[model samples]
Target: MKFTTAIATAILASAAMAAPERGLASRVKARAAAARGSRPLEAAQKPADTTNKTNVQYSSNWSGAVLENPPSASATYTAVTGTFTVPEPTGSGSGSSSASAWVGIDGDTYSDAILQTGVDFTVTDGEASFDAWYEWLPDYAYDFSGIDIAAGDEIVAIVESYSSSSGIAIIENKSNGQKVSKKLSAPDSSSHLGGINAEWIVEDFEENGSLVDLVDFGTVTFTGAEAKAANGESVGVSGATVIDIAQGSQVVTDVTIDGDSEVTVRYV
Candidate 1:
């Protein structure tokens, strides 16, 4: 997950946003502080040092399943697609249970930055809502306002990095044929989005400097998921590795890349 010249790390250092109930920016900033060891938290609360690998927060993180590719210098990624049921979080504890499923370029196999988009499913106080969003890391994720994303909606999420810092994100509610597409620009070239990495993931983003508890999402499957490299090479999950998020020594979830581009994430 580590790439040469950690330019992207600069971008990742600023990408998180707080949950809706948590005064967004401040919460994200708090988490960032904790990630850098700026805050005093319990020894068991800190995420491990994954300086060169794909870093995952022991608190809020991409905690479900992930399939990631290695960095490529001349790669121009395009057309990453996936379909999944928007899961209702099983918030059995004191905090909300939330998770996000998305596809993007960078983050894993690169530095701190990423150009991505997907759907966020949240269950707060026993109520569930699914929303679609797109993000250029170092920036907050923006929800597609007019699009209605509901639970069990067959969704198709796509990200095409047309240029080094330019891309388009599309989210479609396949069941209703309602979709939204947005053009995005990464904040800086440090993103090194081109020829970096591509990922299909389920993440548990942090809020208020703590990792949010993950919901029992059961299983999430990413289908027809593939990327196109700058060299015109079709990228699949052939050599992709399974990424899991853990707390202490206990691995929490599992990911598997099957065949060429099908990926399944199961909650344990």
Candidate 2:
């Protein structure tokens, strides 16, 4: 009698296990069916290692957080459509190059500022030109833009050094920021502004505008930095701004930036 009872108990346990298995099969099938008609599994993908071992690329809609090292305190930046300033310095200046998003200048390398300075600008309407100068050029020529610009739009330009009689505009971003700076091949008689006083005059906010017209006129002489380079403090006696009456009547009245802004500085 005990042996029979033990066998019955074992059978009852097996049956219970089989019943759950059948229920689990049903649940699994339901889950499979739901998966086919419902949320698909997203396979995780690793970002492709695109750190440009050979060439750096420029981004029109660049966004990220970064820290810059070197003679850094404050920084100055401007775009032609209007100006936006930031407060980070990577000790950049003139006499270097920019390719893609980096600028090599003044014996220093730099990335773009994080744009914390809160500097803003405005335009009066119609046509406008983009321009600014850092002590050095960008790692490539993808440096400044002007007046009125939209995100994700591209503007290609050259860095020029002008002293009136002799000038040169280095084609900084014409070939993907890989080649050495080249002389702008735009013929002098061909109505293209090239060489040191390189100008890109964007026309027809009244109609068609091209990257060729984003221009910065006149050379930046020197102002704020020389004082800091000597005194170690940002003391100022105010600065001057030159606006084109043709560029829609100058909606912005004052321009300000932190440090390492304004192309060159002259001690008055």
Candidate 3:
């Protein structure tokens, strides 16, 4: 089964109408024009061979830690949460660069759907800007208004899947004591969540049908990272797979998981 084009169109239209303004509309519109949002890892290599080893993979668009295999075969991840300090993105030259850090469920091993939210940091001609947003892929991200974010601000992102077809995405600006959330539903039955994998990712997302230039987002560390399964078990990044961003021949990011509850990604 596939998402009905008519229904998807209506949903997008409704979301656009309800979107916040004050230059936010243009930002959201720019994102909505993208081909896709947060996506599954495009692994460049296979997993490592050592037991209890950190399986390191490389992707063109994503760099972070993913809990792909659940502890229990019957358990499906239903909720994921993480907190990070917004990075100060530095511009390389006279162009725009962007990146986003988010926590999501079911986009790694199970790619049919993803429930996620986070903040996007961008640098244009040496000026920096931040926008908080939520996304349910394959739909584009929508900006969350009324929450002000800046470099050094602490942010907590949470995504919860109530069912295959329903979920919620939340972003809390802990530094400023502001919060925003949205309850979302799958565009169609075929776009339902699989709830198999959970991830804390720093991503170079698509814009205008191409991957945008990733800014030098010095470092982002996801702390208090946790995922809850449908069977009521909670897990961390202890045994998760680590991924780094590799653009062409040179890897651009470094990912490391510290203990079980922390994952850090650094731009190289």
Candidate 4:
């Protein structure tokens, strides 16, 4: 009934996405704004009201861009570089009328945009909150993809953990020049006897509560990653950089934004 758990919701979202309805972005943005205290009208809405739609509107500072090697354009769902896919879950909660359970549902993955730590991407402020769904794709899952993010003038590394999930997933502090890892928690709850596909993964975040601050790779003592930005020898964690292939290193540090931790780029 309560889809506040990550594992419970991933099962429903794991399935492939169908064609996106036109003007869905605007609707999502409007809904997100309303949820974040920006209220919108709902009672006046009509049943046959499928007319014009608007683009998602956000405050100027809320905008962002990502660098990605995207999938075929024709595909309904595009797994941009920073974005990952989730396989449909087998177990869900769809029972009889007398014994029914319902969970929240949301389906929005990261888009193609180059983002880094401390860049006001994941958590714009030291304290921010949102109600939504997310997934966690660590290094082991993406082959160490989306690693070495920066906040501003730091090595882009931090340590954080999840509250509860059937399994464990955490990022650690630094060790040597590499970002060493330690015990981290994750939310892997799958509810409804794991037999539905319309539940949601819910998230709640608070500032400085089990939070870990991270620095960019250059600022860290032992990061093998080096930045190749035109402005500086190293791009700060917050600065934007492209996903270069000629950088001589195919081994990217493990980064996790699959929705486990509140922070985006954690050190593990």
Candidate 5:
């Protein structure tokens, strides 16, 4: 979602009023950069069987697990939730290195839209920062103010869609007992939710129309991962497709699903 000058100015002004301690420009930058939701796997990348028991896929921008509805299936996902400890990002080179962990519905098999919420971890010049935010694709992510998030905080991310055009994104800082939420709607008809996929993902999000440098986010394990179908049946990560991030020919992430309700992503 490209932000116009007016929109950017409005966001900055509100952010300044909401979070005066964090600089206005940095908050706007983080929110704008966080809007790039999960993208389809690059054509060159394909699903492959790993030496382990699970099937693995490769994507340029995403790592974790995605549960997809079969083409012939009647049930659709309406809610997705996951809990994880925020990983402390370590900066390597210059500039800034960043990563985000989020739980969402759609954007895999149904690529038109995504309803997601998570925490972004970044390290710039050896100083680390964390922000909790929510997004509906085709619009810029909005940072959640009034909540203090830190590395090692346990976070619960959730997205629930009541219809194709409406949903809610919620973030709970379990370690601090603070919560924030937003009622989301499709920005346009093209971005409506289809309820085709539910995911727990660590993403190298986009900024200025390009992907930012991925940081070393140690390892993030999403526990209590669950998705509820429109039929009211709940499911976990078992039988979900595993995805690892690959930059060119070099794979940078290792993803594994443990039992039914846990999925882990490790920076490699």
Candidate 6:
């Protein structure tokens, strides 16, 4: 009798397990049928890498942010403007150390030539000086006359490319409201300005043929940066590239972009 009762209980338990399995199978089938009538799910895809896609190749002579047009665009960038503080050179080097901040058209990825204007800061034997200058590179920069610039002056630099070979550069001392504008004519050359890109750069400028010593300029923030295309459209800093000047692993200076128009460069 005991053996018969145990067998019956075991059969009932097995039946209970089979009943839930059957119910679960039915529910799963119902869900599958409903899903089949709905839209098919898409497979997951990985996000794209923006860091590698939107980047500027770094050079030892430059540390700044540069904005370029789309690859297909034959854009003729017309104007670029920004404001920056003259950074004081404080590096522990024996010789003179210098840094320059400027806004200009071309000379990034699309053109080897640059038409730029800004202020240069230099420190030699613990003395610091500031001078306003303009350059159409492959040529020496020319200094503006009759304007006195000192360190800590807030400056507005504007470069307007009016045509393929003509432009104007303006440098203003925001604190004193003193400013100067000069009409520029690019010297005869094969490398005409393509006007493909615009930049806010802090550069280790070259004298003769060598990179000048970079100054410890703390940080120079460029605000209110504006660039316009030939179509009168407001060009922005999207898809722009940030670069840091490095000597092997030792980064000398770095740059950052804020929002779509502001850039800041720092001596690291």
lDDT of 2 by residue, 1-268 (tens): 3568889999999988865322223323522343111000111222243222221112111111111121233321111111122111111232211111111111111222111101111111222212222212211122222222222222233232221122233222222332223222222332221110111111111001111121221122222222121113332212312111121222111122223333221111
Q: Number of the top candidate by lDDT?
A: 3
- As a TM-score, model 4 comes out at 0.19
Candidate 5 residue spans exceeding 4 A from truth:
1-25, 29-54, 70-73
Kindly report which residue stretches of model 3 are placed more than 4 angstroms away from their true locations once superposed. 1-25, 34-36, 45-54
> What would the TM-score be for candidate 1 when compared with the true structure?
0.73
lDDT winner, 1 or 6: 6
**What is the C-alpha lDDT profile of model 5 across 45-95, one tens digit per residue?**
643433433577777888999997833356788999999999988986557
> Which whole-number lDDT from 0 to 100 does residue 1 have in model 3?
75
For candidate 4, lDDT tens digit of each residue in 81-172?
A: 11111111121232100000001111122211111111112322221211112123211111112233222222222211122121121222
Give candidate 2's TM-score.
0.20
State which candidate, 3 or 6, has the greater TM-score. Answer: 3
Residues 215-252 of candidate 6 have per-residue lDDT tens digits of: 88889998888788777777666557776676555666
**Please, what is the TM-score per model?**
0.73, 0.20, 0.86, 0.19, 0.85, 0.76
Top-down TM-score ranking: 3, 5, 6, 1, 2, 4
Q: lDDT per residue, candidate 3, 184-236, as tens digits? A: 99977888988878999999988777788999999999999999998999998
User: Candidates 1 and 5: which is better by TM-score?
Assistant: 5
Instruction: Write the residue-wise lDDT of candidate 1 on 1-268 in tens digits.
Output: 8765666765555453333343333333543454311111112243344333343333225532333453354445555666777765665534556677888776654555677788867676676667677777766666676777777788888888777778899888888889899998877766546445677788766444555666777788888877777777777776665566566655566666666878887777
Per-residue error for 251 in candidate 4, Å, reads 37
Candidate order by lDDT, decreasing, is 3, 5, 6, 1, 2, 4
Q: If both were scored by TM-score, which would come out higher, candidate 5 or candidate 6?
A: 5
The lDDT of model 2 is 0.21
Query: After aligning candidate 6 to the native by TM-score, how far in Å is the CA of 68 from where it should be?
Result: 2.2
Tell me the RMSD of model 3 versus the true structure. 10.4
